[model samples]
Target: MSRENTLLSASNGGPKQSPVRSNSSDGEKSARQRSQTPKVEFETERVELKKSIKFSGALAILLGNLGGASIFIAPTTILSLTGSPGLAVLMWCVGGLVTLSIAVSVCELALLLPRAGGPYIYTLQVFGNIPGFIILWGFVIFIGFPSWALAAYTGALYMLSLVYPDCPPPESAVKLLAAWLLVGLVALNCTYTSYVTKLQGFFTMAKASAMLIIIISALTTVTSDHTQENLKHFMDNSNTDFGRLCLSVFAGYFSYGGWQIITVLMEEVQNPVKDVPRALVSAMLIAIFLFVLTNMAFYMVLTPNEALQSDAIAMTFGRRLHASLPYLLAILVTLCCIGSVNVVVMGQPRILYAAACLGHMPRLFAMLHYKFLTPWPATFTMFLGALYMLLSGTVALLINYISLYVCIMLLVLLLALLHLRYSHPDREQPFKVPIPVLIVQVILTFALISVSVYEKPHELGFCLLILASAIPVYIVFIYWSNKPRAFVHLVDSFTDFIRKLFLLELPTTYINNHR
Candidate 1:
């Protein structure tokens, strides 16, 4: 057949082109046809996270996260450093203001890019991949695991206190209890997210009620038994120095640390642009009220020296109410620790998942449970890390290592807001933090870093060392290994093993798309 005839026949589906064609024109025509064909691009399937969390659930998370065991522990540290309830209260208020300012900046970022990983997403999007990876590494190693471990540890200690009020429990028993608590919470979160949210809601209400009862009883029933000498020294500023006051502020800031966790679950929130920011502000306001009032309640019954002397200030306050009240207070403190631990476990895995999706980490961390619609692998990974930390008994060391990095992360996030302002000037920001608020936050973050470094140089150095350690990891996993296909394949096999072992059904859509 002639070349033109052959092309016409093929167009009409009459006959296929024969392989025996000899004309040079046919070869050129075939090349032209191939060049004109459009490319077919395949998109990787996305794992859909369940949006079962609502405003109330998110508020509960925020409340639970902010009212960690730190509140019970930090008051004594603040009081010891400040030496006056009045100054400590002022520091609390000031710390809340500083944190709220930073939260406002985070709110703006969360609204702009409402995804998982919270500050990691913000820093990643604004800065770039390396900086983002650093943040993620810091979170996994420093922020998430250590915080969860500490909460579990504190909860275990408080639970033991109920049984052994006179003497401390053995280290082995405490470690075992902490390990069980950490594992149980992780399993709950991995199995079902709805139950986790509901549990958080219940704990939030229970703890808030307990706190309100303490506040009311102290204000109404306590006979203002604070000594005249304590009152005379209420405004005492004799021991106050810049560094000491800064340390008190740091303690208060640590208590107020978890408010920004709302951003970590932005994807699961029903209304990210609206509810997340609202929850952030409302939760912080509620936390500040409870913190100040709880501290005031302590001062109402105990002198400054008495408050400073006790290891557990909340128990001291409760003991003054009634000798038997301390036991009840211990239970409340345990609940607070559990709630905080739950929040940490639930939120931190999302950071790993986010990083994995972005190719900053192994793909296994990004896999969601086929049935539960949760990041099971990431959650399990975090659980293992937390368990290791609990076993090692380095909770305090991990916390100190993360503290400076936390400050640096906050500073970077604020600077990220400023950077995004100019770089993506037209991006939609449903909740815009005023320039003054951002500026104030940046200044405050710098001051906090400077003060922290000046006050605790060794701690700052250790944290910096921990952060710097991420460089080698990033080089190996991302920069040098080039394509991580082997790693990804291994991860997928492990995920499949987990699914089969757990007897969970794979998602129909994922199966279809993969096939």
Candidate 2:
């Protein structure tokens, strides 16, 4: 006390020694430090995904993603659920609008972040690490891997259908072909990024043209009286089953899925903020028109009962034109499936690479082919997962699992958008979805989730169980361990050997500098 008094006396010029001012200065300094932490982390951890995708490339990816085998299979399902051609058509329109609205919201977020992980990156940035990790896990397991497997399986099935028009192929044969297809696609993607995008562009153009020709030819040519009778019952919803109608909308929405593929490649696009939104909107518009017209063409050719009865609606529609047309359509459907598989193979690995760079997974996944700059390790992981699905012969079950998770993830994404608006108000937003539109998106998202839960509670529960399994993974790999483990090191060595064997280029610097 005597020493303190003497020190105070030495500063007697400020006899009022204000503790309040000193405390306030300390608080300000601490606040500044806290604010700068995230800024520093963001600067240090900024991962750079190659910006090679141009406007045309982006558009091609979007179109390729939207025009998958869904177009060939989903129309009949929608018609079956609605029990009326008119309502089914209306459901497609409504589904498109809902998808477009969600896309608009996603476009806003993509502009803000413009990163590689799509919703994973968005949710992580807006909410935090755990939420992002959860979404990433769900995406890789549910959407990405299952989609690749399903496409490959369906493509193989269609290929076999062409080989054996009268009889179905053996399940073992289908599985083998599907596994081979998955491998081939993975190899193509690992070779060169530009080549893959070009392939996608070509596929999009060819498929769109083929669909247009089919639509126009079908609409122009008159069908039998039975087909006309189907059209006459277009409005007859005597059953008026609301649950079935909701399921029809769900099917339509499923067909309208994959529009978010553009967002996942945000960092790859040349002008992500401008081009991504344009590509998304334009692709969805084209898809909506094509889907509705194709359904109209289906009604033009076959009765509702016939459409419901047929396993392959597109082939049936084509058969109406000519006897040989069904085979051609089957081949076309196979091509569509291949294109879809290729698109997923191209896009999904980046999410894994992005996760790895963020320290959510092994850093080996973050490795890029030095010359091609493709994420080969991540691509290989996806290939392995798809191959497992093919071998397990659970393509349908995997698809059902994916559907529930898709709805859940979309809901998470929409919530992320809203949270970003409130939490990151000052963040640069080159494009912003209006609040009202976001609200509508929220409503639609909830409705979709509700339908999924109500219609398939057991499936949803199973998905939740699978998602819960990620908790232990997160606890061990991400939370408990900061350093790479033995298996991770083994994977790294294997990747290195592959690189040397394949004559792939080596990194010029520490690849994980961003980490």
Top-lDDT structure, candidate number: 1
lDDT of 1 by residue, 134-173 (tens): 8887877877888888889899999999999888889899
Give each model a TM-score.
Answer: 0.86, 0.85
Full-model lDDT, candidate 1 = 0.76
lDDT of 1 at 497: 73
lDDT of 2 by residue, 259-305 (tens): 87887877788887678878888888988888888888887777777
* Pairs of residues at least 3 apart in sequence or in different chains that clash in candidate 1: none
Tell me how far the alpha carbon of residue 33 in candidate 2 is from the true structure, in angstroms, after superposition: 36
| lDDT of every predicted structure (CA atoms) | 0.76, 0.76
- Candidate 2: deviation at residue 44, Å? 16
Worst 10 residues of 2 by lDDT: 1-10
